[model samples]
Target chain A: QQPVQSPQAVILREGEDAVINCSSSKALYSVHWYRQKHGEAPVFLMILLKGGEQKGHEKISASFNEKKQQSSLYLTASQLSYSGTYFCGTEYLGSGANNLFFGTGTRLTVIP
Target chain B: EAGVVQSPRYKIIEKKQPVAFWCNPISGHNTLYWYRQNLGQGPELLIRYENEEAVDDSQLPKDRFSAERLKGVDSTLKIQPAELGDSAVYLCASSLVVSSYEQYFGPGTRLTVT
Candidate 1:
């Protein structure tokens, strides 16, 4: 099933911060974050594995809560380059469970 | 290393027409995936392949959509008699492995059904 994302869209001024939340009903073994600009392919940002894990790349960070089966992506000091649709994909572990399910997505627009 | 590659960046066709999209995964990647994205939505997996074997295809529209990764390097997704609703972006992704590995995506082919 597709995970749910909160604040479907948000606008941020340069230097502002924003957070996108993704929640899934099923337990997640890992969560993957990606960003996609208009008319472009999605680019992998970071991946958070199970075990109360957290990961970050530069100004982008994410935290995964195993108990809640949810994850959140944090964009700090947003820049124009950060304007895009962010998607969170969750992965589960089991026999024949190698696929990643993505969330509805949060569109972020940064203004100067 | 080069990233995943997809062909025919854009395609415009009429309903009932057939269309095909090609994808070449990153070198050394062992897993490939096909996804479809509608306007303002996240991509939904249509199928995934590990090497030459189809590991998952539960979301594929088997009736009209078929995909093949002949050599486990490059893949092809075909839609015969495409419908209006098929007018969306077809994305291809690859990873070192499908089991808990990060995925790299291609630019994708935008399909327009008139």
Candidate 2:
């Protein structure tokens, strides 16, 4: 099943921060985040696996709560380049397949 | 190293026609994935290949859609007798290993059904 992302869209200033939440009804093994601009491919941001391990690349960080089947991405001091649709992909641990179920996505716009 | 490569950045065809999209994954990447992204939505798994095998294609519409990853390096997705609802962007991605968290995506091929 696909995950559910909160705050369908968000607008922020250059120096502000934004948090995107992704929740799923099914159990999760890992969560991956990506950003996609219009007419462009989705760019990998970070990944958070089970055991509450948090990973960060640049100002973007993500935390996974395996128990809650939820993950949140934190973008601090956002920049113009951060404007894009954020997607969270979930993987089930027990499945034999390696496919990732993605969420609807959250559109983020950073103003100057 | 080059990322995934897809041909025909854009294509427009009438309904009931046939079209194909090609993808070349990064070298040495054993796992490749094909995703279809509709407007305002995230990419949905269409098929996944490990080496030269298509391990997963449950979401792919078998009646009109089929895919193959020959020789474990390149793949082709074909849609026969396309329908109006088949318009979307086809994305190709790859990772070094199976189920890798990070995936390198290509520019994607936008297909429009007339």
Candidate 3:
């Protein structure tokens, strides 16, 4: 099953903050975040494999909640370069095992 | 070093025609994957290979779609008698191992079935 991403689209100013959430029904082992610009391949942002652990880069970070089977990506002080579609790839415990099932996507537009 | 590479950035073929897409993954990656992405949708896995053996192909449409990874480094995906629905971006990704969730993706081949 595919994970569901919230806020199908988001518009923010260059220094604003935004959050993208991904929820799954299955028990997850890991959550991966990626960003893709128009006509470009998705680029890896971060991967959270441990429960309650959050990883960050620059102003972007993500947290995985094992109990809720959900992941949230946080973009603080968003930059214009952050304009792209964000996707979350989830790895679950069983059934169709060992695959990263991705979410639909969240389009983010950062205005100057 | 170099990232995954795919040939023919774009392809256009008439329905019922045969087409093939090739991929060369990053050096040393042992796992290769083929995913099909429809417009406005996330990619769906078509097939996955560890080395030269396909371990997960349950999502692959066996009747018309086929894939092969020879020598465990390069791979190819082929569609015979393509249907209009087959028009989509074909993405190839590679990782260090099956459980190595972090993947490196190629630019992908945009196929158009007319």
Candidate 4:
């Protein structure tokens, strides 16, 4: 099943902050975050495996809540290069295999 | 190291025609995946392979879609009499192993059926 993401689209100015949320109905074991630019492949940002554990890459970070079956991505002081579609991939518990069900996506646009 | 490689970055074919896509996973990677993504949407898993065997293909349309991985390295996906609805981006991805969480994706093949 696909996860649900909040704020289908967002617009922000440079130096601003944004938060994207992803929620799943089923129990989850891990959550992966990726960003895709136009006409490009999805690039991995980070992955959260444990509940309440947070991981960061540069100014981008993400957290996974195993109990709530949700994950949140935080972008601090956004830059123009941050403009892209962000996708959250979820791996459910008891899946036995490493299969990811991705969310719809969150379109983020950063402006000067 | 090179990421997953897919052939024919773009393809345009008429309805009822057959089409095929090829993929070569990263060396030493034991897991490969095929996903189809429609515009403005995320990638949907079509099939997954562990080594040379297909471990999951439930989402694949068996009636017209078929896939094969030989020697646990290269893979090919074929569609017979493709329909207009099949127009989408086919992506190939690979991970170090079946239990690995990080997946590297290729540029993807864009298919347009008229």
The lDDT leader among the candidates is 4
Question: Ten consecutive residues with minimal summed lDDT in candidate 1 chain A?
Answer: A92-101
Which 10 residues in a row give candidate 3 chain B its minimum summed lDDT? Answer: B95-104
| Chain B TM-score against the true chain B, each candidate | 0.98, 0.97, 0.97, 0.98
| Model 3 regions more than 4 Å off | none
Q: How would you encode candidate 3's per-residue C-alpha lDDT over A13-108 as one tens digit per residue?
A: 999999999999989988889998999898989889855468998899989998999999999999999999999999888654458899999999
Error of 3 at A53 (Å): 2.0
**lDDT of prediction 4:** 0.92
Q: Is the docking of candidate 4 incorrect, acceptable, medium or high quality?
A: medium
Which candidate model has the greater lDDT, 1 or 4? 4
TM per candidate:
0.97, 0.97, 0.97, 0.97
lDDT of each: 0.91, 0.91, 0.91, 0.92
Determine the iRMS, in angstroms, of model 4.
1.0
List pairs with backbone clashes in candidate 1: none
Q: Per-residue lDDT tens digits of candidate 2, residues B1-114? A: 788899989999999999999999989989999999999989999889889998888889999999998789999999999999999999999998885458899999999999
In the predicted model 3, the residue pairs found to clash are none
Worst 10 residues of 4 chain A by lDDT: A45-54
Instruction: For candidate 3, write residues B21-79 as lDDT tens digits.
Output: 99999999999999999998888889989899998999999999999997888999999
Off by over 4 Å in 1: A95-97
